[model samples]
Target: MSAELYDFQDKIAKIPEQEKKAFVLYDVLGYKYKEIAKIMDIKVNSVGVYIHRARTIFFEENDDSSCRSRRPMMSMVWRLVA
Candidate 1:
């Protein structure tokens, strides 16, 4: 794996458990919101909220102004997973 991908995963590993699980299920595992909601026992809408919050927190924590411009963290994550 690339260093950037590894760093992204490491950052994700450091997030709160709820957000981490939601992010992994939805983004990494390609699970639907309803399915994620069932797995998490949260409302369907809450699944979207969790994913959004997770992405925001990930970019905030991982942003590096020196190396590159800030881009959507999910885009990088998708490259890793795909």
Candidate 2:
């Protein structure tokens, strides 16, 4: 049997502005970290921070357990682009 995936765009909506953008652009749109940095006009390193924060927030919202205790396998969750 294959595993199922779920869309978490609703969860992403709760994240801070820059982080939401970074997560959507990088994870959903398949953009590179460097590309997201260029588009956001921020440091390349900051792109990683944004993505990391976004993922953390997303997991925190999705899971009832501690976020640190269970890091979601993000690749298993898809974000719907509308």
Candidate 3:
């Protein structure tokens, strides 16, 4: 894996457990929202919300000074996972 993937994994470990699970299921594992929601026992919409929060938390936890105040764009977020 690349350094960015390492950083992403580290950052993911630091977020809330629910958000981490939600993000991983939907984004990394390619699970459907309904599937994730069923597994998590949350409403389907909450899956999307958790994913959004996860991405935000991922960028916020980074060491980069400029990104501290900025939420990462979805494109950049996917790049880390990709």
**Any runs in candidate 2 off by more than 4 Å, and if so which?**
1-9, 61-82
lDDT of 1 at 7: 88
- Tens digit per residue, CA lDDT, model 2, 3-76: 23233545656899999898878766778989999999999999999888987887774555443321233344
lDDT accuracy of residue 27 in candidate 1 = 69
Q: Name the candidate that leads on TM-score.
A: 1
TM-score of each: 0.66, 0.65, 0.65
CA lDDT, candidate 3, residue 54: 84
- Which lDDT tens digits does candidate 3 get at residues 1-82? 8887787678878779999898878766678899999999999999988887886787674556555322343455678666
Q: What is the C-alpha RMSD of each candidate to the true structure, in Å?
A: 5.0, 6.1, 5.2
Judged by whole-model lDDT over C-alpha atoms, candidate 1 comes out at 0.74
Task: Please give the lDDT score at residue 7 for candidate 3.
Answer: 78
**Inter-residue clash pairs, candidate 1:** none
